[model samples]
Target: MASDGESPVRLAAETWESLFRAQVAVMRKLQAGPAFKKVALNEYDVLFTLSRCPSGWLRLNELNDHVLLSQSSLSRLVERLEKRGLVARMAAPEDGRGVLLKLTDAGAELQKDIGREHVRDISGLLGPALTAAEQKELRRLTEKLRNSVGARH
Candidate 1:
């Protein structure tokens, strides 16, 4: 049973639907924003992911794990980024068959530029709807949920 005495399964499903709808609503707005004109959302996601890596290089397979795209789709997107000179690819030193990826100088700069705008866009959308304390609580809850779901990253 849930805390309010409703069935646990029903509560879970309702909660999931709300969360999913919220994400979709926000994503649609963000996707239509000016910042995304420079690069598609998925491309920016790759750049953003690489920017967070403390290590200079991240393996392609590992990158695949973090992203929502299929492996073949990611491979194609990485190819496009490489062609645009935004990302660099190298063979993994330890494994001849493994590919490694990292952002180029241009990619890093673009990510920073886009990220600044993205944060502002998010703030404008969420700020009025949730108080600071509520935002903090939401973050905490989401992180807990993510952890509970066995995310390796």
Candidate 2:
């Protein structure tokens, strides 16, 4: 039901819409930047995720949780990256059925190279739009929103 006056449900929907739209706008600008030319954005995403792993050999399923792609699609992308020598995969010792993935040295170097340029692009897009403090607040708010939803699941 629609409310004539502002309602909690309406406010929630409006907030979500604003957040999603802002993400899309920022993503489009980042996608067009030169950093992605060397590596497709999704591929870079996978590499970036792996680059952040504290230790070696992140499980494929674990990696999937961190990235935007579906399991099947991520599997294919990993295969392509493996072929290009950008990522490596192995059978999980603890779980025979599980697969583990890691960035190869080449992949690490590439991710680092692209990351520098990508950060520059991101700074250019966000620096002017929000102050450092504002960015920190936005990060905190988004993390809160994400964690709240994640906790339910």
Candidate 1: list runs displaced more than 4 Å: 3-5, 151-153
What's model 1's TM-score?
0.95
Compose the digit string of candidate 1's lDDT tens values, residues 1-153. 888899999998999999999999999999999989999999999999999999968999999989999999999999999999999999999999999999999999999999999999999989999999999999999999999887775
Candidate 2: worst 10 consecutive residues by lDDT?
A: 1-10
Each candidate structure's TM-score, on Cα atoms with residue i matched to residue i, is: 0.95, 0.94
112, model 2: CA deviation in Å?
Answer: 0.3
Look at candidate 2 and tell me the lDDT of residue 18: 95
Per-residue C-alpha lDDT of model 2 across residues 56-79, encoded as one tens digit per residue: 679999999999999999999999
- Candidate 1's C-alpha lDDT? 0.96
Reference-based lDDT, residue 134, model 1: 97
